[model samples]
Target: MRILIAPDKFKGTLTARQAGEAMAAGVREVFPDAAIEIVPVADGGEGTLEAALATGGEERTETVQGPLGEGVEARWVLTGKTAVIETAEASGLRYVRPRVQSALSAHSYGSGQLIKAALDAGAQEIICGVGGSAMTDAGSGALRALGLRVMNNDGARARLGGAALSTALRIDDSGLDPRLKDVQIRIAADVTNPLYGPDGAAQVFGAQKGADAAARSILDDGLRHWAELLHKTNGTDVQIPGAGAAGGFPASFLAFTTATLESGFDLVAELVQLEKALDGVDLLITGEGSMDEQSRFGKAPLAAADRANARRIGTVLAVGRSTLNLEDVTGHGVKALAAAVDCAPSVDEAIAEADRYLQQATVVALRNLDEG
Candidate 1:
């Protein structure tokens, strides 16, 4: 039998690439001679570069700012002249884990550094993956890193992060990277949330990044003010879909440049040529760390399953855990779901040894498929 293996990162445990490798190893134990192809995928959050590299891209690294305003070396990928930048590398929540929780002061300035590095390297087009960010700066920090000066009425630069945008009086693009004038910047967004409001970035994603009720409210107000300032300077409409992504990271980019927002999954899928990869495959496996009702909202695994189902190909999800009922999962065109937690002694233990637990889970999944 021929099988296709594709999975996303397991959060704190396995990366999409690592998960695919583990799944393939388990599949080999059951079907020693089976034809298996592993393709790591992401929903434009983290692991975007790995997805790009899986389909043929080269990676490069440079030092940039971290979420907490610290310095960090981040990575980007290049496919011809098009550069792929994952925001999580420099501005993700992962860097401040265990102790740091609040994204109130997290900044996207480091992401700007990565973009500048890509531009300096002769990239003509930039595909920025704007998910998995820890900052709620509405992208002002990223703009500043790219040479735009964000200043208040006092003629001083504004502080970085979402809360700081409240004092943003004006943004000057005079010193902005000239290459961006001729470059095509695409915002690969995984979420459809708008910039600010009830369902906006600050209220929806802020809590996870360490924002309290009071902090979220502050962030929301700041985003409102920030949006108005941007509109005045460049006519940016903050109501656009995906504008609220990664704590409004795209808001500034959309307002300041001729950037366009597109589905993060579609961009990664096109790079990997996922549709073509599924041809005549007996079973296509795809999954993420967690599968739930939210997965229906433009998440990568659901998209992968639907594509395979259209071809009448069987699709299975080998995930860390699934919170959805059988009907909801089946409705998404997924034939089966296998969770690693089921085989693990405890959730913590499973996460700690994700590779071993996930391999055992995949074995069970493949065995059932064989019997069926």
Candidate 2:
């Protein structure tokens, strides 16, 4: 049997490549003679850069600002003139765990620095993955790094993070990098939240980033204020779907440049040539940390399953846990399922030993399919 294993990261536990390796081990246990190929994938989040580099690229690393003004080593992929930058590499939420008060001060300046580095490297196209952000500055910090100065009521540079945007007065882009006009910027994001409102950035993702009720209110207002400033500066007021992703990161690009928002899964899949990888595969195994109703839409696992199904291939989805039942999973063209939570003693144990539980679950899933 020819089996293809492709999975996304299991959050803080296992990366996509690690999950693929575990699934491969389980496949070997079941069918030692099976031809197994492991291809890790991502939906333009933390693992986007890795997925882009999987096929081969010039990996570049540089010291940039972290979520809280600290220096961090951020990595990106430069393939020819196209560059892949994952926001999580610089302003990732991982760096600000238990976010608390710092969430209000976190900035995306590092992401801008990454873009500048790409420009300096002669990139003609830049694909930025926006997710897992630690700030809700509506991409102000990033724009600032690109020479867009955000001024406060006092005509001075505004403080970093979401809160300070409430008092932000205006912006000046005269000093913005000239090369940005020549580059094609694609913002890769999955969420459909607008820039600021009830279902917007601050109200939805702010709490997770350590914003309380009052803080969320402040952040939401700040985004609104920032939106007005952007409109006054660039004559563009964008509030499109997916603009709220990564703390309204796309809003900045949409306002200042000709950047367009694209589906995260689609962008990365193209970069990794996922469709070609699935050709002639007998069984396609794909999954993420959690599989739920939301996963049925544009998530990478479902996208991968769709590709396999187009080729009349069966699919087995292995995940840390899933809210979808057999019927729901089957409706999505997935033939079988393997959940680490089912194999491990507890949810904590499942995450603590994700690799071990994932392998065991994959083995059981294949055995069950055989019995059926």
Candidate 1 differs from the real structure by a C-alpha RMSD in angstroms, to one decimal, of: 2.0
Model 2 regions lying over 4 Å from their true place: 97-100
Model 1, span 1-372: residue lDDT tens: 889997888877898989998898888888999999998887887878888888688888888889888888899998888899989898888887522245677889999998898888888889898877888888888889888998877889888888888988888899988887888888889888988988999899888888888888888898999888888888767767789999898888887777888898888887788988888798888888888878898888888888888888887788899897546767666676689999899998889999988988888777877776
Off by over 4 Å in 1: 97-102
> What C-alpha lDDT do the candidate models reach, one value each?
0.85, 0.88
RMSD of 2: 1.5
Tens-digit per-residue lDDT, 62-113, candidate 2: 8999989999999999998999998888998888864557778888999999
- For candidate 1, list the clashing residue pairs, or say none: none
Candidate 1 structure, TM-score to reference? 0.94
* Global Cα lDDT for candidate 2: 0.88
Among the numbered candidates, top TM-score falls to: 2
Q: Which ten residues in a row have the lowest lDDT in candidate 2?
A: 97-106
